[model samples]
Target: MDIQYVDTYELTRAGQEVHGQAPIDQFERLIEDLPEQADTMVSWTVKGEMDSFGQRFLRVHVKAAPMLECQRCMKPFEWPVDSHNRLEVVNSEAALNVDDAADADPDDAIIERILGSQRLDVLALVEDEIILSLPYVPKHDVCTLLSEPLEEEPDGDLARPSPFAVLGQLKKD
Candidate 1:
């Protein structure tokens, strides 16, 4: 299915929500980070909300399980992704400066800011969030490769001498 775009201002004012499931392959940037493009479906929901102060914002939620290569084992494994973010729609680019905005208003410190857009791409936003949620180095708690026993050599030599054995001999010298 094609990704949808929405008018940030109108959606927030009307308190509307857009939701859909798109295949993982649809997200180009996300595909580059994955081990392989599997038939994974990413479910996403973008809900517009207005605070009591009349400020417009968007609540983005995404969920998916994509295959990632384990850094430790170099093997492919499924990584669960469930993330939510609140983005305050700002009228100008200056307001997008989180540090400045947070300094001016303490409330802005907690919530992220985004430039208001008439054609806000929901798929891009979802992909960005998923990427941000990913670990810098993806790895399993206990890699199967580590737990499994090493195979014996063709000559039936199962044990290899430790590299540290040379250090032990030097100690005697």
Candidate 2:
């Protein structure tokens, strides 16, 4: 869902009293499109403030139950994930772009944008947080049903290169 920037601005101006639920369909779309396996049920609460840095910031706490395929056994398993995120929405395109380019830190960029904006997109902020919270490699616990060992190769030397390794060899000039 496209969160109304106007509402965000109003909330900030009115002492940042915003609180509510955001649609999760957009987040679901992102998970579906991910190259790796992932599924989650997420909910969040957003609190806005003007930080010491003089930027309008939103502090978000998200709770989720993520389902992912085990890397070792390739079976699905569930894991709980709780994340806290801070975001900033900047007003001017110039300022936003400059902040985006100046530093690669997500938190810093977010704070810059929030403090600089009169309005913010709540949905966008939530989506960004969720994306950031996703694990790079999700694995089940050792005792989980999905955990298992793979069979050893018939050859005693399991580290040997495959026949296809010749594909990388350069032809003689």
Best by lDDT: 1
Instruction: Please estimate how well model 1 matches the true structure, expressed as its whole-model Cα lDDT.
Output: 0.79
- In candidate 1, how many Å is residue 122 off? 0.8
RMSD of 1: 15.0
Q: Write the per-residue lDDT of candidate 2 for residues 129-148, one digit (tens) a residue.
A: 66666667756557345535
Worst 10 residues of 2 by lDDT: 164-173
In candidate 1, list every pair of residues with a backbone clash. none
**Runs in model 1 lying further than 4 Å from the true structure:** 1-3, 98-110, 148-173
Clashes of each: 0, 7
* TM-scores of all predicted structures: 0.78, 0.57
lDDT at 108, model 1? 52
Clashing pairs for model 2 are 56-115, 88-110, 88-113, 88-114, 89-113, 89-114, 90-113
